[model samples]
Target chain A: MQPAVPLVARVVDLVKNYYLEEVVVRALRGITIDFAVGDFVALMGPSGSGKSTLLNLLGCLDRPSSGQYFLGDQDVSTMDDDELSDIRSRYIGFIFQSYNLLAQYTVVENIEVPLLYQGCRLDERTRERCLSLAEMVGLGDRLDHRPMQLSGGQQQRVAIARALVNDPHVILADEPTGNLDSRTSDEIMQLLTQLNRAGKTIIMVTHENDIAAWARRIVRMRDGHVESDVRNDRSTDRPAPAAHAAGLTASANSLWGGDPYRQPLGNDRP
Target chain B: MIPYLCLLLGFGLLWLVVPLAFSDKGRRSFVLALRSLWLHKLRSFLSVLGIIIGTGAVIILMGFGEGSMQDALEDIKRQGATNIMIRSVKASDESSTARQQRIAVYGLTWADYERMQTIPTVVRMVPMRILPLKVHHLERSVKGRVVATTADYAVVNKVQLAAGRFLSDEDDRYMANVAVLGAHVADRLFPFENALGKTVRLDKYFYLVVGVLADRMATSAVGGSSQTAEDFNDDVYIPMQTCRGRFGEKVVSRQSGSWNAEQVELSQVTLTITDMESVRPAGDVVKDLLERYHGTKADWAITIPLDRLEAAEREKERFVGLLFWIGFISLFVGGIGIMNIMLATVTERTREIGIRRALGAKRRDITMQFLIEAVVQTSLGGMVGLLVGMGVVFAGPWVSEHIFDMHRPAVLNVASIFYSVGVALLVGVAFGLYPAWRASRLDPIEALRHE
Candidate 1:
């Protein structure tokens, strides 16, 4: 088969720095990476290894000090803050380890934030889509719960639903399961893995070896440099059952239905 | 007690409504100020106490000043402006002093009267002679000042006839003993009945009352002169010719084995000028004539009615200035109070300002918001003060006249009210600007971090 997905993002020699009282701290030092559409990749690094810095560069949250970052063919490294925010809102979805949901908003309202920022009217159809997204995340009954009222796992799930609300091209998750217990982490990892198999590109940053294993490919960083970029050969073994991954596949079909591999197989759940 | 309570309740209502109506920022700052005040109720009440006392002081003091001015003006108006009065004084001369050791000698004779008539500005001069005598009507007997003058006396002095006719030139020429009664004299002599056509005894002579003169509006006096144009009310008027023929200028008063007697000439000549504008010139002409003819120092005095009226007017303006400054000080203090409170509010709402800026509010909008708050506080205070001031102005006379036994009329001056309110609003903006500018210049990041 042709390589299953085309290149969706490219970064070349991306460098970022911060100034604190005349001292320059280099957060990202000449990092380079390419991410294909529909690919699930995890960035792995120890503390101060620049994994989060690289993710921020990729998501357009911060600009490079002197380097090039491109989404598809657009060079975003030179864009101003407002322009970068616009590009981020339009093309990238973020899920933080802390599940940064606004405390004042309900679960459904939090999920609706990206749409509201997009100037999209909260009409019946848009509201119905929000409800469906909530249902898809298994939060259909807890749509009105505030962030303070929800458990850590449920809040993370709400953040995930919010990330998907804009139907962005790439999902950038930073330590997505770092704050969860093992069972909840497993559940979240399985959900992310199913999304990747259905052709939604996901780039995650994590220090955990087991969490990095959930991705089909991993990029390792040390001292602000990418040390290795390699595919995980073991991901092909004991893949999740078709029935267990049907919801993810269905959502992915709706998101990117033209792809042939996302079609229903004979053993798929009805 | 009930009316007093009602007044207090009305004042309370005014305190509530006036400030709100005049405040520029609508209900937002009002609500905020109210909330802040409620948060620290004792401090708020203490702050407002300053304003209350200040407003009350302005009202009461200004009210009394206004009352005094009105009384002074009324008293000035009562003295006719067109009448030029000339009075006689005792001349210090050795011969006259020795001849009148027991007599009064300062007076105008027929020669002085002829010289006064020669002045071109004099319209009409009425010569007056007085003799202190005991007059009786029926059972009523009272010591009175009797005057002998020409028919022109009534016209020159602006006296009105209440009944019957005044003495005519025919009466003076024929030496008729017909008299015109003064109002008080009529009241005293007739008591319950009309004094017209009644006979009154004056020093062994009987005179019939032809008319009663209207009550005098004001008392007349010259500066440092012992002579006053006596209230015509107590006088029994007769023609000068009749008085000279019937009761001579020499009169004798005997008491306690001592007798005093003297022959005096005309006591005064009251000249009427054609217009108020000519009163000054006419007075100068009469003074020059008296000086040239009398040839003696301290023999005569002249009074200018127009000059007195002008002096009264100047006094009124000074009184208004004093009152305005008193009111202005309180308004200034109130404005400072607003500024102090607004600066505190700006410090307290720093976080709110950051949120608004983050949400895209402009610097001008932030400036306007705080300025509006300051204006609201001061304007409200101004309006309350104004209403209270006016209330005192209107009710002052009523309370004074009825309860305090003072006959004062409260006058509400619109100019003062306008001036006070305008100054108040200006003070509001003047004091409010610095704090509002500080609020507008606040940095969003720092403001967001402020508690």
Candidate 2:
């Protein structure tokens, strides 16, 4: 009887340009895409391929020079900086590869930054929720450690915990595990994959093919244009190991009250 | 006392030394001015030094001036302007040191007294004659100046008789040898005893003491031959006719290696006016009359008590003005010092300003904070200056009397204190405003980014 809810994100004819002196450089040329709710999509591209630009646009850190971009039912291309910031705090969370955690804040305090920007008071309940987010990112034992005191992977985990603190509608990761070792990269990918399985929409930007393989869908771009958009069917049918699945299931239950590890393969809840 | 000093020092420290206390980015311009001032403390202090010295000088000088003026006024009140003084002088060219050969060039004669009585402005004229001699009373003999005057002398000069009665017209007509003892003369001649009604022998004549006169006050004028130390307390007053007949003006003068005698007319004449308004005009009229009677080379002097009173008042006003200006400078300097410190504080706290701006502080809020600080600094300085000024005023008399053997009147009044404090505050605010305004105009982002 009612029209089904539209996908979480949609872009049509998005064009981005940079002005130097009087000349305009086209960073992105008429890119169009759609992403369903709870879908985990990876964007792969070489340098200056517009992957970071798109992520910045979707995260509301920037606006396209020309085009329409809709996050759920709201048109983001027309929003002002203040409005974009508000939307970013309320609906979209970002995790940068460099782990941009404020050095002054401890792990828990970093996790509470989004809520603070959202004007949330640190009451007993909100503080407990921050602690729970820290636990979900495997930072429970390091809640009091400042970013400077933590190792690279640990700092990234704190950044991840901060990103998820506000419970936004979409998670945008720009090279989420690009700076980590192979072992830590797999661990971080597993964490991101587990988050996606629990109903969160994810858009990740990366240059590594191995990192892209972790996502269910991949979009390849070269020189400001999309080369291909493909579904990774082989990776989607294989589930994570049981012990790792159990741990991820526990973190999922803590994050969004769902057992993502026990879900049937190829479920694609969206 | 230490706590009060500590409080004062704390105020100085906050206003003068601290720089980080006033920063805010939203009020960057305001803060920048303050910072500039803070960076140059020495220059600021030097600039305000003139004001500091000026203020202190004004208060101290004015205070002393006012005190001296009050002293002069009190002296005038005691002298009674209704009375006039006439004295006899010798010719300036006279070279003879011999008393017998020296002539009384223009003495106050009996004819002058008679003529003065005819003037409409003259209420009463008392002729007085004096002769320096040794008087005896039993075994004790004292050298003193004896005077013979009419009964009205006591009334004309406002002299209070402590005992017995003054001479009457009958005593003058009969040439009675009745006398009044001055307070000092009485104490010296009859120590541990009363002199009233007692008989004393002057030269070869015996006189009975009728009364003892009260103490005479001191005068500040000097170098005038007019009655220098007229110790009314030491003088014995007799009837006019009795002094002329018994103790004649022809008296012996004894000096080192010289002995001479001379016969002179009246030594002094006192004129009284009926009203105070007529004193100046009457003095002028008498002077004209005396000039006509004597030649252009006349040797006589006239003193008008009223003119002296006016001079004293003028001196007081000038003194007060000078003191006020001096104090004003110091207060101004103090205000500038406060401004300098406040400016520095504004600069030091630029980041704080920015943060507060981001937290929603308005321009007015920053302005109020800096203004309040300036006001607080100046008010505190004013209060300290007041206390120090008061201490100096109060302690002046005590120190003078004890250590210096001098006495000075306390002149620090409530009005002066209030005025000084008010000026200090005004100076503080006026000088502090530019820095405060500069601080209040700072931009939040720029201020936060300030190194």
Candidate 3:
């Protein structure tokens, strides 16, 4: 990995307010954070805790009511919708929890959308790049299939391919593994881990601790405030038994991370 | 599938031409719009329904109207666009003294024809004397109108000769006992054998048939002219001198057991002007000359085809205006339909818009996508309308002749097709503006949160 990477995104005292009729709802309240290149960070918060709000602002999907957002050298806090779109297309890619793939397009088409918006010619070279990205996401054989035809996990992989196709500066994932079962989620997490290992800057939003633990660094939020930011040294804390299971691999955590698995999050629900 | 593909190709060309900073990116917006419409096939089709009908109706109705107008104009035009006719009225509505005269004569004379020729704009003048005379051809006898005129009569009246030849200058100069039989006259007098070269008896004289006329639609007397609406088919045409020599100026009529001789010289005088600009001047000159000669008799009336042509054009313009309004209303309704559908579509696809916005689509991109969808629908509708309109135009004449028995030919004007399609597209884009603006105004966050 490259050393002393530059900051990919930085937010200073960000605030976002929502107007519902005559009432006002404050989604994000004076939050400050910074992310560096090659950093795989997970954002953890409950519903209405403003993690989604911060993700939206970082994705350039919305402007903060106050304070500044800088994606690299560009100040995005005061930009208009068109300028924001330019920033997003240039520097950001998003992976949604529901896998927001357009129904009319096939897996290849969905993956090509961001590139298309970047004014990239969908020539033979562009098509090859798109196919290669699909292959990386393990969707090489499903290029012709539509989102509806694929299972939930496969749909998520297609979304992953889409996000990576543009080769953006950073990937913003809102609940990357929220809708998947344990086995599929592990597979997806492994793919993400490989991408991160390849030095991708991933800022993922998830309420699950186990998913958050997959990240090298974790940022926990509560009521629009950062509760804690810490590094998780899972290799030193966990047992090393069955690290090599000779050719048998049932899950991503087992095959990729050399571990069985743990249900360390969602136990606090209800 | 082809229509959808055609929509894409058309949009692709447009995308390249639009003033966007990034044209290829703009094309992606069109792709998204095309896919969205594909999602709701029925709705998109319904939205364009009004436009199709509007275009079809405008083309079809305009076709029939223009065709019939031209047909009437042609009919009047066949009378010669620059020709003006002056006919004798006979002064029939007068008191007892003139009616009881031995030879009541109130009409154009040979002297008037001579004077009419001297008018500045009068290029040619033809005068004719006609009377219903008993004609005999062997065993067949028919009462046919005998017209005595110069050779210029056939050219001025659009008379076509079937066989043999028309009256030459020599025939008129010599007062030759030769006649040209009209279509119906020949058909009646000599049904099987050819009428040309057949000797026909006119009044008390036997005349050789020099020519036979082809069948033609007889014209009606126009604009208060005293000329009667007579079918020239059952008439015998002879040289000017021949009738004057054989039958003289007096024809003895035996009606209701009473016999009387009415001396009539010239029945009608047709004058051709130099050009269209000379028609009114020529008509005025002829009227002035006749009024000076006949005094207070009111014995002549005039018909100018150029004046009729202008009147017909005015009437057609009014009819076209009416059609235009009706067509415009239909297109307006179609526009409204598109507006309503686009508004609903914007609302329905709010989440998708949010997703696209998040994926880096600018407000202008969103606006263009929606606008292009509306245009595609309308253009497709316009094409369908043009197709249907053409089909109706071709089939209209047949249906009119067979079922309605009204011989109206629907003529398609090339410009109308372009105009209708262009207007339909314009209306669609106009109506689409509101919805596109609405979609573009959507806040990305709020839209994403709109379920």
- In the range B286-312, model 2's lDDT, one tens digit per residue, is 898789886674656787767777766
| lDDT of prediction 3 | 0.80
- Lowest summed lDDT over 10 consecutive residues: which window, candidate 1 chain B? B20-29
- Please write out the lDDT profile of model 1 over residues B270-374, one tens digit for every residue: 887778778888788777877777676667777666676666566667766676666667766766776787788789888766544432344554676676566
Q: Where does model 3 exceed 4 Å of error?
A: A1-5, A235-270, B1-22, B29-42, B90-107, B119-123, B132-143, B162-165, B186-211, B220-230, B245-264, B273-298, B399-406
Fnat per candidate, as a fraction, reads 0.00, 0.00, 0.70
Clashing pairs in 1: B19-B380
User: Sorted by TM-score, highest first, which candidate order results?
Assistant: 3, 1, 2
- Model 3, position B36: C-alpha lDDT score: 73
Candidate 3 similarity to native, TM-score? 0.83
lDDT, candidate 1, at A210: 88
lDDT (10s digit) by residue, model 3, range B309-356 = 777777777876787787789999999999999999899889888877
Candidate 2 C-alpha lDDT tens digits along A1-270: 222644888888999998879998888998998888888899998889998888877877668999999887678899864566556666777777767665545688667666654545556766777788777777889888878898888888887777777676788998989899988898888778877876678999999998989888999988778899998875577576454566655655565444221222122222
